[model samples]
Target: MDVSQVLRMNGGDGDYSYSNNSLLQREVITMTKPIIEDSLTNLYCDMNFPKTLIMADLGCSSGPNTLLVASELVKSIDKIRLELGNSNEPIEIQIYLNDLPHNDFNTIFHSVPKFQKKLTKQMTSYSSSPRCYVSGVPGSFYTRLFLNRSIHFIYSSYSLMWLSKVPEMINTNKGNIYMSRTSPPSVIKAYHEQFQRDFMTFLKCRSEEMVRGGRMVLTLLGRQSDDPCSKECCYVWDLLALSLNDMVSKGLIEEEKVDSFNIPQYTPSSKEVSNEVEKEGSFMIDCLEVSQVNWDASTDHNPIFSKEDAQGYNMGKCMRAVAEPLVLSHFGESIIEGVFERYTNNIKMSMSKEKTKLINVTVSMTRNG
Candidate 1:
């Protein structure tokens, strides 16, 4: 149940190469822009109109999304500058992009030159001098990742729900065999416990790292309801089970091994998220919203796959990428490739029939005095 181990199963490298689908890019950019603007305004207010500020993009993956986040920040800064008027004093803007130690730092760094050029082009409209610095600080978000009170604004996307490791309970022999995806009572409880522990730690660490009144915006996957045992929950453990079943039937995996495998828990409710923040007593909630991500957009456009292959492949690949580590560790690597292949084909088939989507939860908060 080690979450890091599961993450490593997907090639251990942090460079998750994603295709640049214009529609998907636009969707994420639109979702984040308002939150970024609101957080910046609150941060500016908290700073009492400071001429300079610092911001960090926590859990920033190497992709077009990074540039989108930076663009949003620059626009926010421009709005602030327009309100303040031109002055001899230059505004100091420091931006830190953070992620796991194993992430592709080279790709992220290589993109900086292009980002700077883009920033320069965008800033031409503004008359005032603004000094901006962007750098990478690699580490886990559960621990202190920055200097104390150094950040004014923080943004993280689609990354927070991943606990540092899998829940310990799931690893024990007494744990239910179906704990990974099924809504077993013991499995649900164990997941909740781990989530609370990890989330509280996140709040405590951020509280210490952020200056009083600093603002943060986070968007990640979440459940529709607060109930932990609901069948129609956010993480869709059943779908995973279905995909695993396909693998077992193909003789790529043993049925007995699949019985003991557990999918890492997700689907944290808004109430759960709020309670964690309040417990920390340092952050004031500004906004919380949940929306669906168009995960099946590609499928809707593709007509090549057979129905069965389409359904199995699209969902299977999406889930297996995250679940493969668990499968490999428990069942061995001999059958993993075929299992994944079947699952991917299934997902593709599913996608051919209808569009698929991912549920997302967004929370915006500011430090309280």
Candidate 2:
């Protein structure tokens, strides 16, 4: 399928549309802002010297969160400028926001004015004039992203789990035949292998693109436990199963087909991701922390029980959002509306039962100097 077709099949519109600014506010911006800010601070302290920094935000879906990363980078650069006593000199900042070509660049482009306005306000607070340039580079993150040794800092949020493409074994009709969530062990294994291949390529490509001693802060949807079969580890799988079951019950799809399907590889545990990073031998682990995020707090003022609950909640919605298009592709447009309706209802049910919430692992690493 073409990029546009792939986008449409994935619920690229409707709830997943970039115009749904509230998702960016509640889902991406609030969650990513502090992490980016804090990570930038950490990286700044470790760098031996400050220089013109080129930063990239991978998988920067069109929304307010796109600007949040840029904002944090500019702020961090300003802080670095103050420390160097170079606040008087114009500091050059290059910011690249990346995503698939079909992503809503118009929304991203439209927000540039507001983002600049915010930057203008913030820069006015600083003692020196900061020269900041922002550009959008559209492409996949699984492959080469930048020029060799070009980027100083890289940040990606909620993007890595997507495999380069659906696994080839998904269509085979062994005991079970499926693509992402319901296939047999071999299918799941194939998906994981593909994930490993794609992830390693991503790291290796970035390693070449990043200057020595540069840092990357990546937050991805992940499982708490090492076990791949654990419900917490596979919450998205469970949700997809629930949604598929509903489709079958409604006679929209075949039971055997639904049972055989598997989801694209995701929910890699902290250990799994760390192992891959270590094995790749391109980066030194600085900090790897897997904690749950409180997404309910974004909606209500009340504090949640644990980080895992919040993360599960947030992740569940994100999974549905990304999978919305897939469902449309497998099923038909008529079922798209009901699919989301049921999918969201399931998320609310899971939340009320305190079953799952948004969870993620934040990893910060620097290229071996």
Candidate 3:
């Protein structure tokens, strides 16, 4: 499948929009704030208070989360400038918020006015007001999106795991939308190889576009083990697969269609990420932190809690916001409601049996000459 055409989060600011259901992704972004701050600080020092800052937020799905990143970068720069008592020269900041063409760029664009006003109010108290320009760049990150040596810093969160396309040899991965315990050995190898190629391409592209010593911070779901079928990597997709089977049983979806479909996503282990970086030979790793958040952590304000009455339906809504476009592209519109109903029930059942958390890997890197 042409994932670039089909793989998009539910768009717009409606109840099921990515903007509303992406709290989990926001938490992931929050977890990487310190690394991002450090990267910006280092860039400032290395560049000697550069007058212009060019950056991009890859896989930046719409909503407050996209604006949150812009806010953080501007704030970090302001903080650094204030601490150093830098010259009164004005700094111009340009941010390219990037996602697939199908992403809800309109929602992000519409928020730009309010975002700028909020930034203006906050900056009135500060000594300097940085000129910040935010715009959406539509394309696949797997390809070049910027000119060579243009971007000074790059940030991505909860997005790198999506492959440009499904693996070619996935025909053997029947009854599973992702790598699973029952997947054949060839199926596992196909996924691993695909991730390696896609990740290398990502590094290579960034390396070309970024100046020497530039920093890039990325956060995405990952497995703690090399096992492609590890719980941390596949459990969520396994539940979805189970839900699809239930749909098949009830005559809601065709069994052959379910078997034929596979999500073009792969959560790699930290070692796998490190190996690819080292192999690419363009960037040096600064930090590779592994963190975990509960599956239902997006249900409320708090990201942590003892299992109370699990909000399984809410959790399913969050996942649907992310996975719906892909499913709709594959299974058509007929089974959408029934599929999610079964999927939400599966989430509830699994949470009752045991609590589970998704492992996230945040890697900070600096471009090397």
Question: Each prediction's Cα lDDT score?
Answer: 0.67, 0.67, 0.87
Tell me the TM-score of each prediction against the true structure: 0.82, 0.83, 0.96
Kindly indicate the candidate among 1 and 3 with the higher TM-score.
3
Query: Residue by residue across 1-369, what tens digits does model 1's lDDT show?
Result: 555434422432332123222234347658778777877876776677777788888877565667678767876777766676634445778888887775556666777888877777777454464667888987888899888987888888767877776565544422223334334566667778888998899888988889888998987767676665544354245455666687667776667676556555566777888888888788999999877766543232337766455444444544554556567777777877776665565555545566656666789998887
- The stretch of ten residues in a row with the least summed lDDT in candidate 3 is 301-310
Q: List model 2 lDDT by residue over 57-157, tens digit each.
A: 88787666678768877877787667756667666778998888867677778778888877878874544656678899878887787899888899887
Query: Where does model 1 exceed 4 Å of error?
Result: 5-16, 19-26, 83-89, 126-129, 170-182, 229-237, 298-336, 349-356
Which of 2 and 3 is the better model by lDDT? 3
Q: In angstroms, give how far residue 79 of model 2 lies from its true place.
A: 2.7
Q: Where does candidate 3 clash, by residue pair?
A: none
Clash totals in order? 23, 22, 0
Give RMSD to native, each candidate.
Answer: 4.0, 4.7, 2.3
Q: How accurate is candidate 2 locally (lDDT)?
A: 0.67
